[model samples]
Target chain A: MKKTLAAIALASAMMAFGLPAQAAEPIDPIEPVEVKNPALVELGKMLFFEPRLSRSGFISCNSCHNLATGGVDNLVTSIGDRWAQGPINSPTVLNSFGQIAQFWDGRAKTLAEQAAGPIANPLEMASTHEMAVKVISSIPGYGEYFKKAFGDSKVDIQRITDAMAEFERTLVTPNARFDKWLKGDKDALTAQELKGYNLFKSSGCTICHNGAQVGGQSFQKMGLVRPYQTTNTAEGVKAVSGRDQDRMSFKTPMLRNVELTYPYFHDGAVWTLEEAVAIMGDVQLGRRYMKEELADISAFLKTLTGDQPKIEYPVLPPSGPETPKFNPWAPAAK
Target chain B: MKKTLAAIALASAMMAFGLPAQAAEPIDPIEPVEVKNPALVELGKMLFFEPRLSRSGFISCNSCHNLATGGVDNLVTSIGDRWAQGPINSPTVLNSFGQIAQFWDGRAKTLAEQAAGPIANPLEMASTHEMAVKVISSIPGYGEYFKKAFGDSKVDIQRITDAMAEFERTLVTPNARFDKWLKGDKDALTAQELKGYNLFKSSGCTICHNGAQVGGQSFQKMGLVRPYQTTNTAEGVKAVSGRDQDRMSFKTPMLRNVELTYPYFHDGAVWTLEEAVAIMGDVQLGRRYMKEELADISAFLKTLTGDQPKIEYPVLPPSGPETPKFNPWAPAAK
Candidate 1:
């Protein structure tokens, strides 16, 4: 007990300052989030999967961030309204509540604000917020759902986004093998995985990539020690803040469920985790990892998958005769 | 007892002939189908909702025929691959197994045949069978699901379609109020609905519209009495038989959940059930009903909405590194 306590103290001291040894990982690890609003969550789940909210009426939020396929579209970028290509890779919604802000550019601070942007974006859902609200109000079933969720059937865009955020909060993954190991389960990780964890800490990869999500908590330049070349057009943080110096700087993406969300980075150019790890080492730390080290790091990263959201598929209510129908190729209503 | 026996014998004799009486309706109410293969059914459920089978990797079978909103997309016509407008409105997948054949033109003889058409159709999923099979084979997790479903993980398009058909069989909607009424529960339908049913029988509507599905047993010329005029260009049965004389001839669509699967008819021009009923009267029978009669028929159609399939959303497995990444806007690979 005394030795373990000393080790923990030393690890804490190491994490506080810029000191490195084979120290304990500074990651807090994820815990199962409590669903604070059940009614709101239910409404949100429907809205999340509700394609009727879009102009196409066929492209729901679930179209891009599918729950079955790891809360992501699994595309390099999403296919959007009228088959328009999204500007950048869509970040996973699995642990998005933990994200400091929404979107790659951080244009929207709250989930509600972020939610509103997509509906009006001509390249995204391609429906004005007013039209979306008008369509929802026309559906009689949604009125009752709204009333049950928010005390009144008077529908608005704010309630829609709020309900979506409520459900998103419960989507935080928990009980990963590493989290189990962190909680003192000795057999939770294999020998190589433990070795990988130690190496990850000692090699300074944990400096920017730490905390509950192991990376989402901070912003860093895409290429710190070395420059990265890519065909992706995104200028990252500069698009939001309009700061020339902020170019190439992006929010460190969360590593949770990284195994499921493939084709890594903002461009989603990298296919394998080993390649991503090696690239980060060379570009972020100016260190080239040996082949074996890359393999070990990959083994450690696999343990972060955790539990996926397991709720039953909600049976959506049928539409009314008066409800505006989805006609994808139809000319937009003026 | 003798009097009752005489009435039944007389009714049977009349049914055998072309004589129409309020004697007995030929409509056989639908029964709940028993699910035979539970494991295969489970696998089929996943495939039915799997979007990866599409070229865009976003449009799944559910995108057009959504289970959440009555097995049909309720669009005037479906939206398909890369925003292509579908040739016709999607049929209700609910209780489609009861149909004699699949598709509006009855080109595919079975559901499996129908299932395969959309995957490769340039207007639909726009993916070749070979590429789809390759993608599924690359995913290691699907191997287990396939093994459990077919006793082999050898992923093939045949297995994919078979699994989807198996799941679709379980989508049968039973326990409608009309079914109860047919089973001698006098109180199952309201007085107005009963009046509407009687009117429907008194008219020749019951001639083509009989049996378990209320209409899927035979094909008839669409504009029998009066030439139905519309802007839509579907030659119906002629497209298959290549017979010009078979123009506008179509299989009578099942009336089950007709309330949910609107806009009605091959053109999907009519929106309301009342409007459809009125059109059928004028075009098919050359008889326009009174306002009260239209209201009663509308009430009767509402009872066709049976207990919908209550199911949970399935969680699909992650992709392997070898799986082809979806990037529609990306420059074509050499």
Candidate 2:
């Protein structure tokens, strides 16, 4: 009885400290997939930096997916269409290629398809594919680059889409401290970070963010154990699926670089990783974490941030002979 | 005329390389205000740690205002009662005391008043002030400490509110590199940061965020120039003030420690600081910023983040002989 009590106490201590139990096996690390079309990726980078594609002639993909501050723009939702608030959260492009689908609604099937949606969405880029093609084709430099990248100077909408998509593919975050630890470099993470990782898995975050991408494979309701009823308009899959059950069922976003992405969840509701984790335990898993454990989990999440890729804004595209007149979107130019 | 053009060219070249044309005037830096009552701050820190304050007895202020990643809980909006989404964006508490008012709507008159609102609001803490007082009174250690701090053995709602407010006041962020530069430490910021600062002032951000707090004194319409009309019901100040002129007039929030706060603005609308600055120029100021200028501004904003404060979570209060029942809307709670 004494020995059993001692063992139980030890286990309890481990749980309090957020350590994994001795019985569980360690997870094996998976290698990242090599990206194809490096040159296309380079072209995509130029396109991401170009604001001419936007109807406002002021925004671009990098406008929201900033490389300097993680991969996310750090806002809960992106301001687009003359500073109109977007309905859903903007997930980071970092490691997003590993996601099964794109967008909070999972409406787009691939990165290329996803690129097209935002460009044409009334609230986002507010530009049609044809308009985007026309804008890019009109730029002499872009025309030459398109021919070099796609082996055709046709400068069609599909090639532009392909180049932007290819650029997003190369925006993957690589080898975070956690990734290094998973690859058998035990010293990569602090003891607290490791403990947080264990608690993250045992507490059931792994249920959604388990794969190599850490998430982005499925859709889950915001509230699992308890019903999350809000007067806020139904978002996520419900907008696309039109099913009652799909209400508040947002895409399971990738957790890579999550520590850098403030205001977590579909609505950007949660503010800290610790708070989000604690709330998840209560609403999703029906459990509560000790303060120390929550702290550990937060520390672990910070290790996911990798170095931001360096990007240079492309030279402004010169107005072409056949370029559409720059009609000011505002009522009257000052 | 030739000499003037030559000077202009030189200045333009310097700006392109991310440098300022002139040295900045030095200014004295203000020290952070210290909390009045240490014991009360200590007690409030404990309350912040204790999840029992929530309706579910599983969430706390630390759940959202996590110290690890600035002060935000990192969700776009916080999850509260039954995991309901909060209406407004979560601002960082790092230098929140510098603000003119609390909440995005500027509804609360003081931090003490703001502290009580969340505890009883159905969508947030959901705990009545009476219940909160009773719970604290029941704790022996807390009861004793309350008497020492307020000269009463029993814990009243005002004392509870005051204690929490006192604790929150101590959450001041340390001075940033920008502050150091303003104090005449020339090497405090990089050349890019200095250029960004120039663009920030010339681009009209200084029109609102001037003075020591950077902002927090007024409210402004989001689309002052462009008039961003949207059918969405979340039209900021209009929802609070119910006046036509108040449409989308959100409180001018402080820019202190802004780089740490993601999802800028009251609605958490713009994601990156650069994107936010870009939108401010295009929609609010009726101007556009060059790409290099925007980059420089973003670099300068990063200098606003201060060193993290040193804080420790409080201990749980001990149980007492008598306990009062929960009452959310009591005058004392107010």
Candidate 3:
């Protein structure tokens, strides 16, 4: 009863101040992930770095969504199998479990589902599920890891994706200055950052960019007010939804660690943070910001840079004679 | 005086037993490297994983000499700049600092000198030293690291290579079963492994494969007795010396973690350790090994598998505007 009264009082006070009804409440602090099953995590980490999961035996999960550099390859678009160029910018895997769905189009509803897509993707890993399983099963050392991770030594695609997702769940980056500010540390952000936050709220940027993951709560049109020009031919959610209205709509990417994830936008057309901010304002909100305002907004965004996940590079098991040889020049398996 | 007397007594015993002059002393235990300057190592680690040193900004030193799986890519030959296939297998970087010289050709006398070759190789990183320097210099975070590592803020190729070489020097793989046996641990090797070691020494294999690194002391002809056959056009040491006798001669790769570093030999034609042992017996020793002998030699080689280097995946700094943009499609800059 006391908590309910306090909540009501806070809401009334927020209303009185003419602030957004959920002002200071939309953003939430991300907590560090705690692994329940260390064995599973250990196995998953090995799998994540295991290049045998790909047909080329060169690319791994870490190849594109690298944990070392903000969980991304830091490329405009990832270089894929046999140096094939990726069609879109690879999203950061950090804190992705908190998102409502996976991928820019939100095609896969879960992280595990997303994990399976790359292995078979013609331009990416260029591997069939059967071949991946065959390769893993052939390795004698992996059998022990599988037995430890799961109840048995079954090397199935489902188990593979599950373990990978479990490992990715631990990749949450916590303790950014913005997260500190959100957790009620008043001095965490600077005066300029505070002013920028106020401007960001007033300008209505948070309508789509809200909740725990900042922007992952909702899907929004790339150009709400104006057309966003790009050389990329990607049709956003329309490819998944097959709806004309969803043509330019995409899942609003999370703003956490936006500073480290460079070459912004789905097309990765923008390089600098300030430039991305300016373009977002002009295209999405149909507004122009002054240089000082841009600087403040950019400074505020920089505060989102969080403590990156500390990962011990796993020593992958050696391949046995049964393991299939990598065909670097081979086309994607049907 | 006591240690000298014991050594003399042991030498006399070996001579009495009709053992070779060096006998049990041929292979020495590898010692774990103790890092003195952590700051330099830290900086070098960042550079080692820094793809910005490549023209495409996708390949780092770890791409070919990966630390995760025995410090070698495990490919028959490395896939380099624009997916260009390498002419020879990449040697393991582990225990490489202990080598007489770097590369299969023993061209570069120091690890630092060898470090510069890949950055400029058109078929490899495809990056000029100037461009690499420019890119690294533009990143503000690297400046602080360089200052911390060298006691100055200068970002020269010399300091860069020096830092990288220092880091590579720490990549020694110690504490193998063979090392334990060498350190007087009687129970370290199994009966089969001990038998295999005896056969390995008696077959004259220790003539070239000896020392703490188990091979890296000198350059030897690939096929000492019989001619080796391979489609690979690499002329081995002849590429460096330009002498007829040095044509098929190459550096003896250190077999510290031979178990993990698979696809053995210069051309990486043989996949299995047993096969490699058989081929070596036929070509180098002028004798064909029986199946049991091959198995024994292979088992002995597996004892060389050491503790792999434990490394924390480093988080590289974000690229600045001043940093040159990566040209994934561009050819080697003239």
The prediction achieving the highest DockQ against the true structure is 3
lDDT, candidate 2, equals 0.67
lDDT of 2 by residue, A1-334 (tens): 2332454465568668966543332332334446676667767877775555777554567556655445554455665655556676678877777787899889888888888877877677777788988888876667667767877777776777788888877766677777777655668988678767767766678788767677888898878887654444647688888998887787887777777676677766666788888887777788777788788878877787654454533333334445553322434223
Residue B199 in model 3: shift from native, Å?
Answer: 0.8
Q: List, residue by residue over B204-261, the lDDT tens digit for candidate 3.
A: 7888889989998888888889988888888888899889889999888887799988
Residue B290 CA displacement from its true place in model 2, Å: 33
Q: Report the lDDT of model 2 for residue B178.
A: 83
Docking class of 1: medium
For model 1 the local lDDT of residue B311 reads: 69
TM-scores vs. true structure, each candidate = 0.90, 0.48, 0.93
Tens-digit lDDT track of model 3 for A17-93: 87653345667778878899888888888888888888788999999888877888778898988898999999999
lDDT at B139 for candidate 1?
82
Candidate 1 lDDT by residue in tens digits, A180-232: 88876768989788677777777777787788888777778999999988899
- The fnat of each candidate, in order, is 0.77, 0.00, 0.69
Over 4 Å off in model 2, which ranges?
Answer: A1-35, A229-231, A325-328, A331-334, B1-334
